[model samples]
Target: MSDLNKLGLAEARDALRAGDVTSVELTESCLKAIDEADALNAFVHKTPEIALERAKAADDRIKGGDAPSMCGLPIGVKDLFCTKGVPSQAASKILEGFKPEYESTVSQQLVDAGAVMLGKLNMDEFAMGSSNETSAYGNAVSPWRRGNDDAQLTPGGSSGGSASAVSADLCLAATGTDTGGSIRQPAAFVGITGIKPTYGRCSRWGIVAFASSLDQAGPMTKNVRDAAIMLETMCGHDPKDSTSAELAVPNFEAMLTGDIRGKKIGIPKEYRMDGMPSEIEKLWADGAAMLKDAGAEMVDISLPHTKYALPAYYVIAPAEASSNLARYDGVRYGRRAQLAQGDGITEMYEKTRAEGFGHEVQRRVMIGTYVLSAGFYDAYYNRARKVRNLIKKDFEDVFAKGIDAILTPATPSASFGLGEMTEADPVQMYLNDVFTVTVNLAGLPGISVPAGLDSQGLPLGLQLIGRPWDEGDLLNTAYALENAAGFVAKPGKWW
Candidate 1:
């Protein structure tokens, strides 16, 4: 049981069912770890009392012979989701004191499946940044490298804390939201596995919007199976989210065929960019080789619109974000700016928004406002939407041409110094999602699997993308890759 900190989801659950441990004990262990490693800032809200209480309920249910899928495990919930009493800040000061009257559909679904909520994890303010520096609560450190007095590294955002906490063993698995590369990138930065299910697979009912069309809630965990378990508990149809697919949730766990003996994997030719470091390129080449060794036939495919993905995402995401965030104009449940004005309510709105949002958020709001304005709407926003449709259509064409999944690099480079990227041009920072944004625009299921490490000892990852509603295949394929590559390693200095 002392080794429980490194145990995967299946192993941990078996430990509980075999009476080798109790839910309360696991929850207490997590609470202790979180307390001891407070410097990571991995969590924004710690509700140990609520967690223990829920663990007790889970134990009672299990003893009564009625345990559900997740049984008594502890899990971290990203702060973007609304909790009835918990302050859901989205890691931004604008929503600092806001609390919701109801729980998010995904959060409620997790609770229903018997998973204990350990706490609310930190994230980029409304899931914006790639390296997590934009978080209002400060950056979450990667659990991978934390000793010898070096500057702390980012735990990738906007799901940074979710990845950090899970890798550090503060929780069994954590919830994450991906808009652009939020889930997969952070998971890579922290040396873990995360999946962004096909858009509309997981409900977005209570999540703060980044780009409504792009934002998706998914799972981050230590291993592929844990991700599967968490996703099984997360996905379903929800009436509140109009974009949610009405189709029935498939049995994901049962669908993992492990044997990819005859599957065809597409290696998109556009992903092999000129700027990628030689080492990462080697990782990709070796990764494809491993898949070939596992009997998957690899072929080159083209997404000619790939270069347009980043610009398209920047336009579409901010445009939608601008409209959605307008609801937070002081009258609703967010920051209210104090302004002296002779004008009516409009002045209050002007002042409140001006002072509440951070620089990045402000920039996005202004851009969103400009793009959606009457004169520019057709030229910018409408054009971007049409391009987004083309990106999705490209994926549809490739998959229909008989490819089970597509492969690519998660980020152009492995985790660099936090300020190295963020301090540069913001467009340069947006380019980190160059390889990832297209999947989001296409509304596809994408994942990042820990492939190997760069010379700097930073972990590198390869992404696997699947057709809509085919997350099980992606996970299974990642599992096979994991088996072949055998590159699993936690943050060497985390302990």
Candidate 2:
């Protein structure tokens, strides 16, 4: 029998069906791992009692021969989701003691599929930073290291905690919401597999809004198979979210045949930056070669608007965030801070918001407010929207010309030291999303497959971008690549 903690969701399900391992025992092992990984600050709040009860019920379900796809599998959820009765903070003081009466559609779907909720994982306050250091709780350290390296390295943000927890065996899989490279970047940093589905495939009904238009929830897991299982469970149509498309979701688990023959793959020419490490470049070349070997055609393509994506995304995301966060101004929900004796409502609103939001959160709020302000609205916000449309058009143009999907490096570089990027200007940090955010802007689907290791031994990820509302194609292509790469996750002893 394999160690309970080492098994992914599918394997865990198999064991439960065979009566080899009970759900309670699996939940206990995950709880133990969570306790051990606590020093890494991978979680904001852990629901041990709820998890145990759920696991026991799962055991009963399996015993009675009534189990859904993910029955008995424990999953760590990022704090951005609204979990009923659980503190669903976006990892900030502003949302302190705020518990929603309703569950996020994504989290509810997971629960309905019988996945035990292990806890709420940590993240950047309102999903704002590249490094996990921006998290209000603390930083999530990468589970992997270079040889015997002892320095604490960042598990990428803002989905950093979910990535770390999955890689460290805290849960079988985890849920992550990507606004700008959140899911894919952290998976690369922590040596795990994560996929960002087509924007509208998964409902965003109860997800705490950062940039509502760009946010797409997806899965982080040990490998492609678990990712497939999670994607299948998380995707579907719900009238609750108007943005959700009305289409039939393919059987993602059944579609992972690893047969990608005669498919045309486009390699964007603009992604080859000057400072790109030799290892990453080789990985890119190797990925193209592997696709060719798999009987796929690799074509050189160009996205002219690539260079402008980062700036446009920064402007647009903050503009939307400024509008969405307005609801949290000491009135409807969240905590209210103390004001001066003479202060009534106005000062209380200002003071509460000031004390609640972290530095990065406050910074984004200010930027958003400025961009959405009356005088600058057209020049900044509207211009960014136009640029975003152009970027989306670039993808549409390639897809129209018979491209099955496009490829790029998930991040320009591998994981860095905890505080390395925080000291630099915010623009430098925003540049990390240059490759991944374009897909979000275009409402396309993308997946990050483990390609290779960098000079520092941290994982390098290869991304595949699919057409809008085509998550199935993205999953199929990623499944083929995962098979070709034969990437296996090996957690470090320190984990």
Candidate 3:
């Protein structure tokens, strides 16, 4: 009973069905663990009362034999999601105390499936930074420390809190949104499984807007199977989001046959970045070898536009972000700046924005504004969009040649110390997404599976990018990698 919080989603689902445990008990166990994990700073908003209430209902549903796979399983919601009446801040001060009146589409879908929401998790402010340091709630520290060094490490950003909460056993799983690798990079840093579904597969309605075209919600869980179960529930067509795909949602958990034999796995030479860590290089090679053992044919491939992906992503994401974030002025809601005597409307807007946004958020908004300005619109934004199309076409060309899945390292390196890269050039931090931005740029499905440990015993992950609308096949391939790698390392209970 005490260890119910540590159980994965599938394990808890089975335990609930078998009558060995109750949802209320599991919820209590998780709430207790979260209370003890303040040092991790993973869960920024605690909703124990709501969690227990949902758990009681789940128990009733189970008694009626109407439980879904996620019924009663305690999980965290990323702050980017607007849970009705819950503070959906997106971890930025600008939106501080701003609770949404309506629930985000993805979260509402999970509630319909009966999953319990423990609370809102922390993240990079507006999902901007690679490291979790940009979060206003403070860094969501990784549970895995450097080898006996006691240095607090960062659980990767944007989805950093989701990764930390899942890895630390504070929750069974958590919701994560990926825009330029927010979900996968952090999952890699913290040793969890996170998937960014094909763009438009998950409705963007009600989610706090960042780069609207690039944002997609997915699940971060303890294993590939758990991700499959949660992803199915999180995905569906919503009329509110014009970009939502009108397609049937598949039972992703049932499709995890782990039989990826004869599947074509593309190994892109462009992913082999200059000065990439030797350990990551070796880990990627080892992942390829394991897939070969599982009967996956590995073939060398090229995505020529890969070199321009990072630059193009930076330009385009900020441009969209600037446009989407303009509504946060003090006139509507959220924090308002104190006005000086006789200040005008322009002054009020300027003061509110300058005082509200953090360095990273402000930096992005400024860059976005500059790029979208009349003089630079064609020079930067339009050119970046063109490059983005070329990048997408590159993946299409590969898949046209029958590549079932593309394999790459999830991040350039393992988790780093909290403030190590934040003080340096911001590009040093942006480089963390080198291996991941291409996936988002192409609007494809991607997953990060914990593959192995580095020399310091910290976990590293391998990424699998799949065809558009083919997450079932993508997850199956990741399932094979998960089995082959057999990465079962857990961070010691330091938090």
* Residue 322 shift from truth in candidate 3, angstroms: 0.5
Alpha-carbon RMSD, each predicted model: 1.6, 1.3, 0.7
Computed on alpha carbons, the lDDT of every model, listed in order, comes to 0.86, 0.87, 0.94
Off by over 4 Å in 1: 146-149, 341-343
Off by over 4 Å in 3: none
Candidate order, lDDT descending: 3, 2, 1
The lowest-lDDT stretch of 10 consecutive residues in candidate 1 is 143-152
The candidate with the higher lDDT, 1 or 2, is 2
User: What is the clash count of model 2?
Assistant: 0
Which candidate order results from sorting by TM-score in descending order?
A: 3, 2, 1
RMSD (Cα, Å) of candidate 1?
Answer: 1.6
Clashing pairs in 1: 144-491
lDDT of model 1, residue 388: 91
What would the TM-score be for candidate 3 when compared with the true structure?
0.99
- Top candidate when judged by TM-score against the true structure: 3
Write one digit per residue (lDDT tens) for candidate 3, span 1-495.
Answer: 668889999999999999999999999999999999999999999999899999999999999999889998999999999999899999988898899899999999999889999999999999998888988899899999879989999899899999999999999999999999999999999899999999999999989999988999999999999999999999999999999999999999899999988999999999989999999999999999999999999999999999999999999999999999999899988999999999999999999999889999999999999999999999999999999999999999999999999999999999999889855599999999999899998999999999999999899999999999999999999999999999999999976
- The sequence of per-residue lDDT tens digits that candidate 1 reaches over residues 153-231 is 8888889999889988888889999999999998887788999999999999998888988999999988787888889
lDDT of 2 by residue, 144-227 (tens): 777677878888889999988888888899999899889998888777888888888999999999999999999999888889
Name the lDDT value of residue 216 in candidate 3.
92
